[model samples]
Target: MPRRHVKLHARPPQEVQGEAVDVLVRRGLDDLRRELDVPPSFPPDVLAEAADVVRRGPSGSRVDATDVPFVTIDPEGSKDLDQAVHIGRLGDGFRVQYAIADVAAWVQAGGAIDDEARRRVETLYAPDGRTPLHPPSLSEGAASLLPDQVAPALLWTIDLDAAGAPVQVGVHRASVRSRSQLTYTGAQAAIDDGSAGETLQLLREVGLLRQAAERARGGITLPTPEQVVEQGADGVWTLGSRATLPVEEWNAQISLLTGMCAARLMLDGKVGILRTLPDADPRDVQRLRLSAHALGVPWPDGATPGDVIRDLDAANPRHAALLTDATSLLRGAAYVAFDGELPAFTMHAAIAAPYAHTTAPLRRLVDRFVGETCLALSAGTPVPDWVRDALPELPGLMSAGDKHAAELERGCLDLVEAALLTGREGQVFEGAIVDVRADRDEGVVQLRDPAVRGRIEGAGLPLGEDVRVRVVEASVPQRTVRFALADDQADSASA
Candidate 1:
């Protein structure tokens, strides 16, 4: 792993003219859909089932929890709400009432909807739109825990001590209502201005405690800034980076807390799926240390990789490059399933604990099954026959969906980069070499402006060093960008 130069700014509006990047994006989306074999729409049977369920409303026995004033926090404009929370301080601990959308209640086992969800595995997201795992009639309307709507849910009541360690856990089918739908930004604003209601204020306190506990467990949290593409009112697309927000992390802690509880239940019951990742390889860690040294970043003695990474500034290009290189240490993530015996490896290295996906069933397929398993175990009943039969096949199905999702995300980014740099060929820009082919004369370089990454054609390009390079080509149809070191600079370095 090596550090590469990356550009970090969006082009000014005056400079971006004539070309319709949105049209190019649409074309790219079509290309990706064809290449990836994305489904056009839900099967007729699945849609019909969804419509029927929507008309019928929630069925089966459920405990009424509509008295709890829970609120959902997600990104702005999100509709497929999955989870809601209400936190309160008890005598010496905290009580967390987390209500997750009970999607399985609406989708019967071996039914048309279930069959379609198995094939889809998970929702696929793109900048333009999303290919939802379940039909919108169910995922967005009926199953969603929208504000003021009573939805069937799997309610988890977790009691935690002052140190944020779980002292008790309970899960059951319940009908719940959310009092409000809050965005991450809105919740954060309330906390900062001291205008937050009792539940939100308690959320901040419990969230901080949980985060501190995670850090104490040696969990790794990468500070990678997200590269976002936004279309203006005038319909011009611009690319920029957004730092992770505090409220986002705090909200995620609640989800993580629930996931950990789910994992514990499955492990204790000796049956379920676990999200596992091997510990960072020693060799990869050594290489990352070398990379850090090359980038002039410090790795204090006796510091764990997570300790060092957690403190790096995301704004630093070198730190960003280091984080990109650290991807090697995070390989081999998988879903492990078992019925009668426990898996030898159970920990998710990033979390430094056993974890499972039992939340976000509205967006993810596995959560629905995991939630069912946890519910059955909590109720002291036998695991459902359908869930038990599907355990072994889940790993492969989820892996395929994960691959498709990663490719779609990367492909979209590549397409946007090509469209944005379409007419800027041959312009020299400052960049750093992030990676090099062992047996070739080319290496990957990241530019500083527009924050584009592409291959540079040059012999002996210094790894982890800043250099000037000219954009050799930008091809929108091929979705490719290539660069070459400036002639004088190459000659000088050779001299």
Candidate 2:
């Protein structure tokens, strides 16, 4: 899986340049987008339809609920807002009202915009820009959950009991206005300083309760810190990393709560799609235990992988190695659609629940269909035939989009790593072996200073141990970086 990085790799020219080497980085990313067959622009007909829809305005059937003091949270500078939330405390419980962008409201079932979105599958992100599933006129404009905009949305009111488990759930179309838009950093700062409003404070209380509940339920969330590739004020590309903020997880819980509810609704209605991952193989689990023991991380008796992972800090070298290795179990995620028959495998290994993607309809294609399906299920209305028709094709489309996104992202990151190391061939750097292949002759070495990971060549490279490695190769065009044990050269000379 390609890790999600905070990329400054948006549109080129004056913005991306940090100097001369930055030019190479920019070119490499462009090559990657082309290689992935990413569509550069929306079709003319689709653009026209999106513009027409924007002019016509949102659905008139939406109920008035703009008085709800909703707020949006996301990365800084994000414009394609999808979900807005308002949380208030109930008697010994919490009430969460989440408003999801009603993409289906603006997109007619068989229109050109719909057909184009189907062909595109989902949004694709790169360092330069995003290939949006819907044009900006809709995704970032009319259909967005921008603050104070009074947009049409599918409003979900979920009431959770004292233990953070859902006690009641209902969803309907409504006209919503977000009171404010906040970034994770901004929200966390407010809460930490004790200056947050009722919603932010309640978010902290409810989020902690939900996190505790997740741990209690053996849910797995491998929040492996992202390798951030950024450009400094000097226009120089720099590589660093940061862990997911506490607020991010809490906000994500709200989305996950809605998705779980959506999955429940579809399951009861016997017609919907799901985001599923099979349980990890027992042998892999046992192997991970051995890895943990080798890395000096103690695994308590009868502790689930999620339990151990929850306590392991990604900042620690030993813990990071284990987290890197544990990613193997998170593979095989897929989309499953059903009309009458329920799929046996519905649990998302990470979420540890029957989950669906219902919150991010702007960026993800399936969430629109899911939101529509769940709405019909909640309203006791028939599932739209168009949604039913799109279900089977969704898996392939999403899978392809996921593949392209992962490939493009990984390629871009690799290019940066290679370019950053290009002039330092043969230089020794301190790094820890975070992962080793089954053969034990090669492994992944994460550098301490630059925060880059690359293949290390050697026999029996010690996992989790700090070692010095000499860069053997850095190819910008190839998007590769390879290192060899510094001792390899010493051993040869001594012999």
Candidate 3:
């Protein structure tokens, strides 16, 4: 397994001083698309076929489960709803029914929609918009698990014992109607104000149980604050960091639970695609310990990396920097597809579990096939020929999409930061030294006020210490920002 370096997004700057950032980000995104050869739109025939599929509606055999009060929880304005969940207490245990969009039901094998989806692999997101893998008519319309609308879904009914570990897992195709569409904020408020209905409350309970189980299994959870681009009242784009809500984690646990169950199914059934990550290198862990010491974060004696990381505060700049640098430990994530023999490696290091992605078929390409595999295995039927043939090709296709997604995210952030600091070159700003190069000639500094991260050319700068820096360059076209230590700060460091 190869190592994968995952970069964390910084919080938005306090104030953005310049023109609206939307135009610049839009242009940069277009350039990135061209450079990556990302498909601009679905082929016209694919769209027409999607429309025809929508009219034809769900076909073949499926269990009717519209009575289940499943609900969707996503970002405030998300249209491409993927998974809807229903939870209930069963005696001393729990039952979770997760419904994933039945994309395979609508997309025929080797058809126009299927061909285009195979090419795109996954949805590519930008600040201004997104390039979807499937036509919106299916991804967001007929196939989406919107409220009160019956839609085709791959349903997973998982029975968990009191310890939150799955005791039984069942998967099948079904017609499901979401009772309502809820957002993270709304769900959190409901949980806080005692307005949360039975399902939401049960979801919280099961989510926490699963979270505890994850930790007990030595899983690593990094509560890194997200840098988000938002529009102000005047329509100017600004970057800011948003803290992850408890509800978000709780909701995510449901997905993780389903994924783990799916992985076990595949391992037992002898064929499927899995999201796998190798364990962190011992050298990386030692380096992280040294970093924690320098950053004044406590890594108590005999503590595992996961234990120490689970307690860090995301709001603290030093801790955030440590998390950013910790990306070095979480590399080599890849999709492994198998037919008869199980892959030599099966566990995802971060999750500390054998995991398969079966919950977000609408957004991801591999999940579609994983869902199909689970359904077939549960029914004691053979895996579809299309899905079996696709196993070998999915890893490469998904890898390409992963690279494009990362580039789009990081590139947009770089463009926004450069735009925000265009006229502020040569101005001194306070920042923290988040990272240092081995050569000691330069390091990565994160500005305190504007929340901009850029390279600084300075020697002997202490990691995790604050210093005054002068912005030497900011170029929007190149999406680069360079800084140098202020005169007094440089002199003091040298001394």
Residues 1-495, model 1: lDDT tens digits: 111223344344434356466777778879888898889899888999899988987778999999999999988888999999999887799999999999988998899999998888889887778899999998888899999999999999999998878999999999999999999879889989999998888887888888788888888888776666666666666666666567778889999999999999999999999999999999999999998998898999988898888887655657767877888888999999999999999999989999999889988889998999999999999999999999999999999989988888888788888888887888888877777664889888877667778888878877767889988888877889999889877996577
Q: Give RMSD to native, each candidate.
A: 3.1, 3.6, 4.0
Query: To one decimal, what is the Cα RMSD in angstroms of model 2 from the true structure?
Result: 3.6
What is the C-alpha lDDT profile of model 2 across 125-212, one tens digit per residue? 7666678989999989999999889899999999999988999999999999999999998998998999999889988888888888
| Evaluation by TM-score, superior candidate among 1 and 3 | 3
| Residue 163 local lDDT, model 2 | 84
Give the runs in model 1 whose Cα sits over 4 Å from its true position: 1-19, 430-432, 436-441, 459-467, 487-495
> Tens digit of lDDT per residue, candidate 3, span 1-495?
011212334334333355445566566668867877878777889989998998888767898999999999999989899999999998899999999999998999899998898888888877778888899998889989999999999999999999888999999989999999999989989999999998899888998998899889899987776667655555566666667778889899999999998999899999999999999999999999998988889998989898888887755668767887788889999999999998999999999999988888888899999999999999999999999999999999999888878887888788878877777789999888878884969989877666778999988976777889999999888989999999999999899
Estimated TM-score for each candidate:
0.94, 0.94, 0.94
lDDT of 1 at 227: 67
Give the range of the ten consecutive residues with the poorest summed lDDT in model 3.
1-10
Point out where model 2 deviates above 4 Å.
1-19, 438-440, 488-495
lDDT of 2 at 348: 86
